[model samples]
Target: MIRIPTLRHVATRSLRCAARGAVQQRRWAQVHDVRFLTTQPSQAILEKYREKLSKKASQEGHGSIDDLKAAYSEKIQEQRKKDSTEGTPVSQPNAPSSFPPSKPAPKKASSSGEKPAIKPLGDILDLEKVAELPEKELTAIWRLRHASSPQTLCAVIPAPAYQAMESLARSNPYFVLPVPHESQGAEMHFMQWTFDPASKTSTVLFTQLAEYKARGEFAQPHTTVTHHLDLIKDKGLVLMQGQVMEGRNVQPDHAKWLVMCLQRFYGGWEQKGDELDGQRKERAEERQKLLEWFTNGDPRFSVEKLLEEAERMG
Candidate 1:
């Protein structure tokens, strides 16, 4: 004989069916509340891979994982540049790329989506017609010139700074040459300068004299560090520069010396300029007060009127 189902069994069977249907319906739409269930690699997984990469980089002669990554990025950049330049794909002998071949990776950008900076243009110098450029255009040309060889510019100090330093240096008949990180004990130094108004060029001689009658092996420029300054008056710019006479037999720390000397001169020049400006301002203010005092504090009368009255009385 067939048996009838109890009331509790019937309710339980309905609940089970409902749960199965819910699971089926919500499979794709379910929120991933668990941390590790996301598609992207977790922090721990990334760190684990980074460590493995570091080891591989060491074996492959890279200084660090960062170095390896930089080299790889450089190679890719070079490849892209080659393709862009030659209009053809070139086979690279370098190691294969880390990314999957099936999908092309997206270009990397800054958070603001700024375009990547291209390699700077170098080995270009055009002085002709550079003078006719307006101030803004001239500044552009200056930037390009500086960018091409920034290291060379460290040795180039402003003309104003050199003039200010020259005035101070002349106070002493003979002084020690200022070399960064070195001392010239008992040895004297001096400068001899000549200017040509026509060419607007100043030739400065930075001479080093050895100790009186106390001699060891003496090296040139015993008196030979020469600097040439060319003034561009029309553009309100000075093309002053100091250069070694020769490439050989120079100071071991020549680069450092140039940098330090430039720093000192620039600082002194700025300070002197500020002082001179302050003095002029103070004098003008005093002259204005004197005029006001004479005019019984009238706003209408100015220093010009006072001078005019004095000239009329004479």
Candidate 2:
């Protein structure tokens, strides 16, 4: 219902904020997959905007959003050209559209001879086992599972799709999502993705603008939620983690709700998504073509191995 995929370009995420610093009558709420904490740490949101300038856009624009984007886009293209010229095998970039990585360690690959083949993600991966896979294996599995799923923002994207995402992210870096369920607290949230090239990780920030000024003398937006995303070492598996920054009497249910909303957001994009019959038909046709291609022994995806992995794990 949140339609988070509407701003699917950079895979924008929720934010974690610092709740303890405030003397006002507000509390903090944090949400993450593997961990939870009540003491609000301002690390997430503040870190993202640390580089933001306070003045009008500069022509020289050192550290300007547009400048940073142009530089990154050029660098991305350069990397692609380098890969092509040097005959580099396609892999996930060091910084995938500016995302990060983290989470529980995945299972170490075990030696097995007669493992079953891997299946599509819709077949339902053992989220637990999958979570424990080594970064490289996890990334490979992510690609194998979701490579052709329409509208997903995944690592190992096609050149064209990656370019499109870059264009969208650079041109419009943030998304303002209207939240009906959260309207009583805040009408809309300002969501942005901070891609850190230095650390090769990305952070998603969700800020709820306080309708009125804060209770303190210096007024500020009431809520800030932050999430950190990372790509597995080389294969580029994504790790989605978050912590809530502000709220009152927040319960564990709130964290669950936030996670579900984010999961749905990454599931789709565009208004129609894959809802229409025509779109579904087209998707099915394309998938069939891929199946045919793989059936004939396409080397792109180690289909057999993936199937083996899927079957072994599932």
Candidate 3:
């Protein structure tokens, strides 16, 4: 009843339990090793892994294993385009032999073969052949008495008197003995005066368009003024005094030059104009005296007596 087992029996039972545990562990180890080599993955498990990879690729954008093949193909096409654009020759191991090489086009010539030549003035004018020039030029040469038309004729004389003036004009200063042209005749003279010294006087002639065109010989002067220049007393004033003949003097340049010369000699002619004014006043006083004599002596025109008589009658 309640008796303990012996030592030998206990050792033998413990060894048996230990050996069964070792056998169970070896069986579990064999199952784990074989599963690694022979067991196939399930479809559901594969689907879960594929979903995880797709999620990872979507999170990282296009830089994924699935898109790598397309990216590589695009890179190859871009390289080919770059090479062609840069004019770099591309070497292919097996290239097509059907296409031919291109060549550059030749340059074209200008449409117009040559430019026109310019003519010299000598060729246009033909100076060697004077007769070949136009009729107008010939007429101008004949009328002007020179190659170009002249404007003024100047002659310095000894004094301002008319006798001295006439002598100088006849001898020189002008182109004398001009040959008359048929249909055109000769040009008329437009004359003026300029003085070199205040004492010395000169008769000047100018060419006007009308006078130059007129078909006649030179006529009498349009105007003749005997200007007295008193260099000593008046300094430089030209006295248009003594006898001033305002003939037909149409040329203003003649008069202007005369005035300018007078101003150069004398400061101004305002005092001369004043002297003329005194002469005019004296003449007016003489006229008043003549009118008074007629009114008083001849009773018919007495205005005061007529008015008094009329008032008395009224």
Each candidate structure's TM-score, on Cα atoms with residue i matched to residue i, is 0.31, 0.30, 0.16
lDDT of 1 at 286: 44
- Winner by TM-score between candidate 2 and candidate 1: 1
Better of 1 and 3 by lDDT: 1
**Candidate with maximal lDDT:** 1
Q: Model 2: runs farther than 4 Å from truth?
A: 1-167, 182-186, 211-233, 246-314
Task: Give the lDDT ranking, best first.
Answer: 1, 2, 3
Off by over 4 Å in 3: 1-200, 203-208, 212-217, 232-236, 241-314
Best by TM-score: 1
* Model 2, C-alpha of 131: deviation from truth (Å): 12
Give per-residue CA lDDT, model 1, range 1-314, as digits (tens): 11112222332333354456654322212111111111222344336578897888999999986687666764453343222222111122241232112222235454546333221111112234444456555444343333333122212344566665545434321222222112111112222333434333433334332221121111223222222233234444443323333343334244334333333322323434555577545544443343334324335533233222222212
How far is 159's C-alpha from truth in model 2 (Å)? 13
Q: Clashes in each model (backbone N, CA, C under 3 Å)?
A: 0, 30, 4
Per residue, candidate 2 scores C-alpha lDDT tens digits across 1-314 of: 33322221111122212224333322212111111111223344434554552232354455564454454554443332222112112233442432223232333232543221211121233445654566676556555433342222234332332333333444334433333222122133334444545333344444442321121111122222222122233323333323343343333333334334332232222222335577645544443333333334344423222222212211
Candidate 1 has a TM-score of 0.31
User: lDDT score, residue 243, model 1?
Assistant: 34
What's model 3's overall lDDT? 0.29
lDDT pick, better of 2 and 3: 2
**How well does candidate 2 match the true structure in TM-score terms?**
0.30
lDDT by residue (tens digit), candidate 3, 108-129: 2224332111111122222334
